[model samples]
Target: MDSAASEKSIIALDGWLKSPAGIYVREWEQACLDELTANIFGYNAVQVGMPQIDALAANRMPNKWQAATRMSNLDELALAAGNKQIAVALDFAELPFASQSLDLVVMPHVLEFAAEPHQVLREVERVLIPEGQVIICGFNPASLWGVRQGVRRITRSPYLPVAGEFISMPRMKDWLKLLNLGVTRSHFGCYAPPCRSTHWLNRFAFMENAGKRWWPYLGAVYMVHAVKRVKGMTLIGPAWNKKSASASQGVPATNRK
Candidate 1:
């Protein structure tokens, strides 16, 4: 049931992405993802979901792939018809890639709408090699947009997709920590009020500057870059063992006295 609901949610969100509001949201997230993945060094990079925007456009990884549950042709994606990288159909909860093979994975607005967001993340984590990176883009629920969404829900209308369970930044960070993925950096954008009219949106555009200067972290959306860290890697030195033995000898000798 969750999977079916998730699929329906994604289909609805995909339709929403074609709207003016969705375009507004995409502009901010696209620029953020481009910069975050541009200079990142990696061999195998994959972008899961949201083929409308090429998440790895700026990334220079030798091998790149886009995996999604639904069909997305080359015409819709930046991956040209003849390009080596092609979009593949796969479930987010169960990725087809081998374990510890991917160097980088981009999830643009995938988690917020996923029924099994944690399981989706676990699949990404499984494919990423130790120290590998994953870039996540999502709608922030602590901003003006979030407030607006709440108001919409009361009126039986939602500005954003109603099916999505928007995760907060701190909560997202916690989920990553649980999976051994440490958030190295994050960015926020889309400060202007969500409006249908281009004029109204443009008039409030100045809020972008003010919002960044005054409340940078409270943007309408955010992109998080986290790296998988393997702990317990520090090797104990023989000298430390010898020091411990000496310290134990002192305690025994003193006890005898």
Candidate 2:
């Protein structure tokens, strides 16, 4: 609910929407949207970023109502999706909504730019029901795009105006665990390369397909589907046990007891 953070997020989102890479990013985002729409476990859903695009992609989903927020694009997209409920605000990393109020939360590249990713993810966990699903799409820091960024840095030139951390899937998985969420499935793709000149490479689909199946670690982006675990679930970890001595004679006890 920080107004300043909200403004920054809005500005960043606007810039991204106007970028060439944003188009490809949106295509990847649509993949997540399609999955979410197909699995509406609740009557209400909320999209955290790029509400307009999400609404457009999720137009056919049946829900009592869908709400989207982030910057000012909510209204137009909501109208297009035939949804009347809309919330205009920012700092989605720290949502103002009540606990377990939403059943589904879709984040498209929201984590890559987040200054405090863990905080944002925890907030997402807070707002989702126990069974709610959080679908996230983020850039892979260890992929071809990552290599391109490294080259840019080496040459003292960068594609993105603002530099942020490129999070890996393993790191994100750990973050989810800290928030008591379990990752059920993950998909990685965008192997066509990060250069604008290589846009035609996407038409083949073979690169992305084979890359995801055979070389997930090298995919440019990754989509993860995580479900919030019910509170108080017992988590088992490694256990270390040592033999105890008998109280009477102080004799060493066996491991059997």
Candidate 3:
């Protein structure tokens, strides 16, 4: 597709997000993000892409930013400013942050749409401080939705954005492992089949619980929380208390004698 067509599709997708299916996705993601970021204390945090959804709203970081490749319009920028969120327009593959500066970085459905997903991950690893955390949200290509999308593709109609290149969980894990980003916590959700109608989706609500127990890995969406692990770096703690050590060791050998 040409740039013009791609832009049009993106705009249509923006509309699609207001549909029942989109609302379902947003609700699940928002709840998961809230739980994941509520206790993540940090000085600097950023939510990259998807300005429409404030992924870091639950976080208490002193400095939180909304970073996107491009703002859909000036109103969006004004709204972000009104919300006291600093918004920056920049390329994901070339973030304009200093190395080891960010304590937290959240990417919401960014990698699939990015031109160079690997390079984007590299930038994330570069800007994060040691032990800093990164939360990633993505569409799983091993789910019922994936199967639906596959079938639709054969007939030239796609269930998801034509631009998205969904990545599987194992593949995403491998990418993070290569950058020494150790997976700490993760979740899978959205078990309902690919249905645009709200009523049908609600009918399958029971599958959410059932899928988690019977086929947890087959959920349509996944969230991954990883911490940057620096090689050969050891966290230092306060020195042992001399008095406590002496008490535990008892009196000196000569005194005891």
**Model 2 accuracy (lDDT, Cα):** 0.68
TM-score of 2: 0.74
Best by TM-score: 3
Residues 212-251 of candidate 1 have per-residue lDDT tens digits of 8999999999998999998876646656677778878777
Put down candidate 3 lDDT per residue, 1-257, tens digits, no spaces: 43344345546556767888778888899899999999999799988876657788788888987775453575765585345365554467778789999999999887877767898899999999999999999888899988888888576777777677789989999999999999998899999999889999999999999999999999999999999999999989999999989886897767865
> Which candidate would rank higher by lDDT, 2 or 3?
3
Ranking by lDDT: 1, 3, 2
Per-residue lDDT over 10-96 for candidate 2, one digit per residue giving the tens place of the 0 to 100 score: 566557656666666667667666865675556557666555465335434344333344545554666644543555545556676
Model 1 global lDDT (CA atoms, 0 to 1) = 0.84
Worst 10 residues of 2 by lDDT: 240-249
Off by over 4 Å in 1: 70-84, 87-90, 234-257
Cα deviation of 140 in candidate 2 (Å)? 0.5
Best-to-worst TM-score order = 3, 1, 2
Error of 2 at 131 (Å): 1.3
TM-score of 3: 0.89
lDDT for 50 in candidate 2 is 53
